[model samples]
Target: MQRAFLPSFLLLSALAAGLNEARAARLVAPATVQDTIVMRLPNRATLTLTVRDAAQLRQLKNYHLDSLTTRLATYITQAEAAAKAGTTNQVTMRFYPDKDQPGQNLPEEIRITAHKPGTDGEKGPTKTQVFLNKKFGIVTTKDGDGHNSFSIGTDGNATANAREDSLKREKRRRSASVELGFDIGLTTLVNSSSTASLQVPSYNNWRSTYINFGLFYVQPLHYTKKSKLAFTIGPEFSGNYIRLTGNDQWVQNGNRTFVETAPDAKQIQQATLYVGTLNLPVMLRLKLKNKEDRTTLSAGIGGFGGTRLTSNIKTEYRLAGTDYNSEDKISGTLNLTPWTYGLQGEIGFHALQLFAKYNMNELFKEGQGPKTHLLTVGLNVLGF
Candidate 1:
């Protein structure tokens, strides 16, 4: 058996989970100037973990208190066994960093110490990486080539062309693969101004939702292969919803569209305008950091142009005398812009990303409907 004891702070996280959420919050001290947190257990064990950067803050945000408590308990039990078999009373445990996983993510690290300072002190350097595949961990990494690389290793000194080559290899391997994308986010009007003649109701930004679905060809930028930049083209369909804040409902008269209060306002439950479009997007993608095929941090900026496919106003209401509810879906041109183009950008870790789009065209034709453009912000997860 080995003399082992984790920093006591990490051990508290396991116990803290059992407490009420409010109490547990008190147990976690805010990160210090050094971005390190030290948590102490009631048993006098303390744990300390350092946050390297703001990106690592996402890892902390992703932690699940429930699963962590269970893991900590199990780890403590294993330490007890190790201590019983060996002569050392000290025990140590570690947590790995999360690498853009879909489900519950991993915590960066937790150190628990049971004894006073320097008690059976293991002065070994804190190791950040763990390579379970020992056979693959070659002894020497003297050259730049990947002949002695570890699993999931990335060369920070890689040239721009090397990154381009990496992109090319990815394309060659999945050239036939179709990219399926789903985007969901919030929508708002850039201009909510209304004139005396045109009464435009302000939109409820928080309630307005946007969603999109797309199937596209992942055509990499062949011309930029020698450069650090990469580009792609794709096709897709997207939908936007604008929920008016007041009782005003959309009114469409031929090519003209405006908003007016409903006759029976009390009966209305929900009023929302929906618009759909079919789109073609050309994007420039850049990877900030990579872990083999897994890009740790990536970003993209692009533009899209799409034609309006469908437009309708949906209203839900309940009957005054009865408990019955009804929905009214009135389809129309609504004087909305026939075609639209916009600039979009995204920044993300792995496949989960945050995106924003600004529509260059107005939501409706000049002098019709609300004199406003569309702006959308939300998160997306990419898949093959």
Candidate 2:
């Protein structure tokens, strides 16, 4: 009977022990910062977790926040000076913390200090001071502290400084891959058809075809491994020609009002002229994905304002087919000059290319019978 009672008591004790262990496992301590704080233990010494309101809890979580803040602050100042070549007057900083490391246990503590380019002690510590509190998990330090300090484990500054140095090294690698290229292509005009039965009553109609060609040089303002921005300014020359046709019209203005023995109407003759222009081009260029073997497409729009540097027109009468040399017949004062403005687009494949341009401005003078539209399609030698 005694042996049986002993076995029964031992079994009851084991059952009670198991129930208590389960209850303890279910009871979790509430975290002050987390609305739903979950503390996980990955092993004897590590933790895995997530934090959503790190910024709101920054004051309470000053140590980690300070680590991120100091790292960002150093990066901003150094990056700006590097970008502008010691020309940056001010700096801005941002902080990003590890969201997956939120638990009662922390790894290490660090403090970061910035030194001038050459000297270690001349700056006399960092320019600003940071203070932290662990109980509230916040940065409780006042602004009066010239130096800021955050406490997690102790090596926060060293870690932050290492990252800042890495970024500086990367920026140097990109600025070395920049280049500039020059290009030139021919521009030609297409002509319209003329009819003999449609002779102008007052003025002769004239038309001509011409070609212009030029070279351009561009320089890169900024260059990185992947992108480049450039500015181009250059001059161009154009050759022009003109063709003329004859026109005449007769009208009766006088009626029988004066009874002057049926007055006859008189016929009037009219003339047309074609002019040529020489232009200068100025433009800006931007290229993206500047890889060695990659195909890149770039577009540029510019205005070419030209002067009537030269002019030639040939005149012919409709009835007699008589050819008249109108080249010297019209003076610069009597003839209208040609001026134009255009926009251009280009697509590049590897080092080969295709280009197109449209002239937005009218090609003819004010009173010309028909309006002209100039379009150019060609290949770009410079694959930029």
Candidate 3:
């Protein structure tokens, strides 16, 4: 009887063990195929989720799968719209596991962040955050920064910034500025009769040291988008030094002017005539190149009126073969013109200008000396 009871116990134990093994096999068996969902976030990150089994995939379909897809579609639509409008946007979605299957592994919440197109209306970055309920505890995972970041598009709207910058530059270009210029040229007497007793020396004896310095207020005039003109008015200080070839004294005999050689004159070291004037110049300049260009071509025409500040004749001499030297500066003795007027013209590329001027008035007072005009040709160095 004890042997029979032992066999029954062994058989019962084997059956129970077999049943437990079958149950474990059913729980651990792999599903026919795995299903997955992939989501892309605004910040260029990817989120991939694998369903646990066929039952879990079915549950997702029956529960909130369609609604989730719909919500995501809505978010994309809104984000695209906002981008078109040059704005930013965000979206949030909830993914709930089936209440009937509390033990099912499913995400609890999903948050989507998107941005509108940038200034150019192009698609921007996105971010996604997923909250999951795990066996250990609730866990949070993020694929991106979860912030909206926009991209600049190629649309015309992007030009707004460029246009603003261009406007600023244009304003500066059109603003008022101070200008300075230097002039150097040959100074000579014109329209003089050769037989005149008070004739100035010819060009061979003339000094090419005429210099002028100017300071001006320049105002730009804009007539069109690409065209510009300027009005410049300035004070110019000018001086002319004329050197004579011979040792001669310029003498005034009551009313007549003559150059006389001294009896003791052996060698004429230097004889110079100096004239200083303060002039007022009015000019109009037309620019031939676009204002944006670094180098521009310009043409200018102007006139000047001036008063003679001072005039003098200086002579330096030495006795022939002797160390004796003499120098004399005679001022206010030459009957020079008290007033002067001239027409000036210039052509330039950028800062370098070639200029010419012709004096309309005589260099000396009428009937006091030979009738002569002043002609100047030189380079004008301009600065901003």
Instruction: Give per-residue CA lDDT, model 3, range 87-191, as digits (tens).
Output: 334333344443424654444544444444333333344433333333111111111222322211112122223433554574567677888878888877677
Q: Number of the top candidate by TM-score?
A: 3
TM-score on alpha carbons, each prediction: 0.53, 0.35, 0.54
Which lDDT value does model 1 have at 230? Answer: 59
Report the lDDT tens digits of candidate 2 across residue range 183-216.
4444343343223422222221123333445655
Full-model lDDT, candidate 2: 0.37
Misplaced by over 4 Å in model 3 are 1-166, 194-196, 203-206, 223-227, 252-256, 261-264, 290-292
RMSD per candidate (Å) reads 21.4, 20.3, 21.8
Q: What is the lDDT of residue 62 in candidate 3?
A: 27
Clash pairs, candidate 3, are: 42-125, 42-126, 42-127, 43-126, 83-117, 120-153
Between candidates 1 and 2, name the one with more favorable lDDT: 1
